[model samples]
Target: MMLDADQRRTFAALADVLIPASGPMPSATAAGVPDALLDQALGYRPDLAELFAEAVARCTGKDPEAALDTLAAQQPEQFQALTLLTAGAYFLSPRTKAALAYDPPPRSALDDVDSYIDMLSTVVDRGFAIR
Candidate 1:
């Protein structure tokens, strides 16, 4: 999509913060960009690529500090939705090591289906953590 490089970087950084490095999975920076999925996203929703540049300008105070209050206050659903979307992309990315990463083993039976759903539940609980 032709977003400015700065915007792309901001979006990536935002994704990093939203998902962070929790549990066994690596941080977004460590995981790096999911090149294939990102390319797919760029091809599909070009405008979505600008979400960070658009949100951060007004959400973060005055452009220097890293905080998210007014933005969440104003956008609410949009803010959390952006976090979920990017986090989903990142979580599905190949960088996660033991937990989130999918390893195709030669077994017909599966395990931990409930845990998978629980992990998905975290998306429903988008608690603000800029504290």
Candidate 2:
């Protein structure tokens, strides 16, 4: 589930429109949204591959902004897939994450059994019921 060269080019164009450079942030293409980063994103969410491909195909040879507007208006699902994949791929870039200061440290899960004791008791008392 990978984009062909033309599809990748179209996707890059559309992605740049959606996520252009701003302040310290790079545009989507600058962040590799259409290359390895995009491949990583598609690997992570394979469900989006088909719809994302359709979006790229639909927008081919059209004005990126106008195509996005039309897709958003007339084919919302495809637009959503395109936007999600574009943003997801852009954010997947190490450079993009660094620019946004979005490094999230791993945190250990907290044990909060005491806080849910009352709710757990109520549910336990109700027991399981089959319709």
| Winning model by TM-score | 2
Give the Cα lDDT of each candidate: 0.57, 0.89
Poorly placed runs, candidate 2 (over 4 Å): 103-110, 128-131
lDDT of 2 at 27: 96
TM-scores for all predictions: 0.52, 0.84
Instruction: Tell me the TM-score of model 2.
Output: 0.84
Cα distance off (Å), candidate 2, residue 50: 1.5
Which 10 consecutive positions of candidate 2 have the poorest summed lDDT?
A: 102-111
* Candidate 2 lDDT by residue in tens digits, 1-131: 86789888898889989999999999998888899988898898999888888888999999999999999998899999989988888878888988988658988699788979988898889998887
User: Which residue pairs collide, candidate 2?
Assistant: none
- Which lDDT tens digits does candidate 1 get at residues 1-131? 45455555665666666667767877765665434545554455555656644664454333322544555777765576456556655655666644564677797676989999998789669765675
Name the TM-score of candidate 1. Answer: 0.52
| Model 1 local distance difference test score | 0.57
